[model samples]
Target: MNETKLHDLIEKMTLEEKAAQMSQVVSSFIHKGSSDEKITGPFAGMEVANEDMTGSGSVLGATGADNLRTIQKAYLERSRLGIPLLFMADVIHGYKTVFPVPLALGCTWDPKAVEESAAIAAKESAAAGLHVTFSPMVDLVRDPRWGRVMESTGEDPYLNGVLARALVRGYQGDDLKNDQSKLAACVKHFAAYGAPEGGRDYNTVDMSRRQLMEYYLPAYEAALDEGAELVMTAFNTVEGIPATSNKWLMRDLLRKEMGFDGVLISDWGAVQEAIPHGVAADNRDAALKAVTAGLDIEMMTPCYVQHLKTLVEENVISEALLDEAVLRILKLKNKLGLFENPYRGADTELEETVMLSETHRKAARETAAKSCVLLKNEGVLPLRKSQNVALIGPFAESTDLMGPWSIFGEEKDVVSVRTGMTEKLDTEPAVEKGCDIEAVLPEQLEAAVEAAKQAEVVVLALGEHSEMSGEAGSRTNIKLPDAQLQLVAEVKKLGKPLVTVLFNGRPLDLHGVVDESNAVLEAWYPGTEAGHAVADLLFGDTNPSGKLTMSFPHNVGQVPVYYNSFNTGRPKDQIDPEDRFASKYLDAPNGPLFPFGFGLSYTTFTYSSLALSSEVMEENGTIRVSVNVQNTGAVAGEETVQMYVRDLVGEVVRPVKELKGFSKIHLEPGETKQVVFEVDEESLKYHHSDLTYTCDAGEFIVSVGPDSRNTEEGRFSYSPAGRSGQE
Candidate 1:
């Protein structure tokens, strides 16, 4: 929207109208299984749930298409300023055409696919009548023990930033005012919500300013740069105050410095919870604090509707501060074309036409298949297509295979592994109830043993349930939840070739599984078509090439470890056969079980020596780095050609290596493709000590790889002229 139009809308709002903009609707994850779900959290200020939500409205789940129409109509007609409400829903994995969870999508490491998924989600949710989606969670999660990691993209900020822009672009599209698209994308948990102490939900986050800027804050900035219309505050506190009321974080840092002029929404009553954090006296005070602190929209909290008017009339909050929030909201509505047409994007045909079409399902299937990372394979994978496969585990036929935060996404509609296998097979293989991975039953165990004894190959399905890892479901131990470890050990003792497929949300401590299973696939809640996708890989119909978006720690104590960590002053001797105090762990290795960008295929690929156009290129000069990749394995497969850059010299300490770019490619056996990456000056830019992004003349290492660790050795220097793509 133009500034003049925004200014006009701002001029038109009354005091009450201004207060209404400070509020928004919510759709909580909570459900009673029978009654209409209640909008929980701080929204008690509301009189009741209604079709028209003006005083910081709340969306409770996917209200039917008709109900959404009613809600939109009521808001457009009854609102004091004629401002349309922002209808929101947790369209996390998928709105209707479910795909892999965020953690699994990260494994794909294909930004185009990631962006496409978000775009598909935007199309479906907008069709269903939502104006916003609280998604593309960009928190830098390191601890797999934290359940919310399932919601984040991954651990690396660079990758997160890239994905953030993709999600934002996909969600908002070219223009939010346009019809047939979803609402504004919300990049969440404003600051360091992932680095919580003890990996607990809503725990305190304490870190250096450098860590915040260099790591956690980049994705938020990227989202803003991509024109994301909204930003949601985190539930956790940074330094001391909860992020919702953090002036330094919300105003000084995000607004003033970052120049984000979008509405700031609080996460599910986070504003009022500050009272418990000793930051506010009560809900009334919380309302006063949040708006003044720069949170324009109280997400679930009716803190504003219940108390902000009183606060403003009492002169506790300046009228100007309240107007600031109203102006932002008005600008958003105007941008959404709500002020002009209110129902600009609503379409009955599009809603029914594309919400669950075969095209979307096919995309979901491909995405789900690509997101599975083959963690362990000793040539036992790529099972014969004609073999009689035994699919074992409690969840082999699970109706709730999709992970947490799903919008009532169904399992029956989702193609199960058992079902997918049958559809793909020329002959129907014997399917048996081989005992529940979680359920402890001697009879089922004996039956499973007997089944495994007869089959040539076993596809053991095991992992957390759909509800086990998101939001309020943090875990103390990231290992497989049930006695699945014992079960795997028990099954392995029989020693028939086994391929274990994991259905988890967060990174699990697979120490036991790794040791016993012949081949392992991290198939993190692969949405609706998960079963079919898994079957495709197992039956050798498709080769798995999904890389780990996040680090898989060897153990839980190695929490917070990621690839971009700075080199310690006293570095560990990674090559030492025998050394003490080398910064190496006594019980385990110094690296993750699965590093970022690490994935395996049924086939192998060879990385050629790095060839640069010029090893000594000037900073402004364009240098092309090329590497020839050969598919050495017999089967045809896709490989993610990754590029990592290192500024050997910097004003301050820098990461050992950082992901610059990546591309996905498919190659037949023995086929070679020369891939090229252009690195000018922008790829070498970094924030200086004075807090300005600068490109320095320095030596750099351009590591080409199938994954982070698997790279050819190379050295190059980038001499500065001036950086393009600078902010």
Candidate 2:
């Protein structure tokens, strides 16, 4: 339908019907048990009657083709105007065929692979009748204590922004209106939801406007730039105003400045919870503030349905605001072709054929293999099949590899570590149920130790349970559980080669595990193909090229440690060796256990001769930095060459190093390739004291390396014409 027809349809809608368009509810409200089988969150008394739900414009937490078809048939049959209901769900990482969590995907540093993962997710979920997936959560996360960091790409704005666009492209595809296998991407937690105070979920976020724009807002902007169809408001307040009701943020910044004209929706219960945030006196006031503030849809809440029309009638909120909101909602439905065919992708036949299909599983396996990061390898990895290996742990036979947000992924269908190893090895290895994930038993530890003693090498699989890291899954301690650590210590005493393959969601503190194991692989909750992917990396079928997108702190006390932190006035490097007055930690090093962009590979790659094309670059000119990377080892591998830039001086404090460009290249043994990057004026720009983005005339350092900690450096100067000299 075109604008004219959509406008005509809106003209025919009564105020109540228009208000219903602005309200959304769970699948239970429309057809019971659709989402109730695994309802984990609190929603006992939040049910909306079937009569009230028949007119709702959208439904959340509803999936499966048959289930959605039944509900949509019931909904449209009871509708007066016959407007189709939009089916939305949280298809965060994957649908029925789960993929690695977003954090693990970021470690690949291969946006192409990342995009394919989203595409596979889009295909599977769309076939199951989901139109919009609240995914590609582009929040810039620096703190691992915030559990939802698993959903984000990670700490770097440039990296997050790049992956955000990749996910948007994968979900939205080329044409959302015509493609049945694509779903509209909803980039979520608008504004700075990831920087909550104390690394707490839904906690207060206090930061300067410049800090918010400089460090936090880029990923959201990048998602919008990729034509994300929907933007979900964050739960936290931005600059003293809740994101759900901050007009300056939702309207002035998101819509006007960011050039996002898509539908803006509130996170679950966020609009009604504005009362708790002390921004609104009641649900009615919340309705007024949210609508006026430019929120188009209130998810899983009755505030808009019960008070929006009344507020409009009382002139507390403008009718035009309601009209604008409703029009955007209607336009989205029309664009999705919902009016023509309410069951857009709800085909049970296609769902069965596509859900966890063999082809989809293959991609999931390959992508999962790429996502696993090799944190440490002392020549014990790429285990030879001839070696007598013992796969021992809770995850050895357990099928809980699918992490959080995999609502449709079945645990039974997941391949376990033992199952994957059997298929890869000439002889099946002995396996034992090691100590539990969170607790250790005497018998369990004894059995695991006996199994390790008999094998030539120990492949100890351990990590946080599936419930440990996700939404509301924050933890004060980011280390391995005592039980798992004990299991590692016992296995280490066996005097056998040990390989630790972790299955976790967030970056964990590996102080103890790394020391005990000769090899450590951060195989973060590798999805349905978890077993196959881990085997491939273990046996050298695939080289491990994944890098950490988020820094792993040395301890919980260094919670927010990251590579791009700005240097203080009394810099640690310049401080006196014996002086205790510097900005150094007394007990721990002022660095991460694993720095951002840090990862190890089975083979080694050498970086040499960082060269700059020019000593100086004028305004509108480009500078070229080139470096040679060679595979020095006797095996094929992929190398992620990272380029970082440091501004010598700026009006505002600057990070000592910021990732500017990166390239992933495959190399055969003894192969050398020259990787070049062009640094333009855009690369030199920064958020100034006045929040203006411009570059100053100053010297800059360009470094190229395998990771953030170690790099080869070159110096150059960038001078924009008419810009003042360095302060």
lDDT of 1 by residue, 518-614 (tens): 9998999999888889988887787898999888898888877788877776677544657675776788877888898899998899988689888
Per-residue lDDT of candidate 2, residues 181-287 (tens digit): 89999998988999999888999998999998998988888888898999999999999999999999999999898998889999888887788899999878888
Model 2 clash tally, residue pairs: 0
Worst 10-residue lDDT window for candidate 2 reads 42-51
Clashing pairs in 2: none
User: Which regions of candidate 1 are displaced past 4 Å?
Assistant: 1-14, 25-62, 75-81, 344-349, 433-437, 574-577, 718-727
lDDT of each: 0.78, 0.88
- The TM-scores of all predictions, comma-separated, are 0.92, 0.98
Using lDDT as the measure, which candidate wins? 2
Worst 10 residues of 1 by lDDT: 29-38
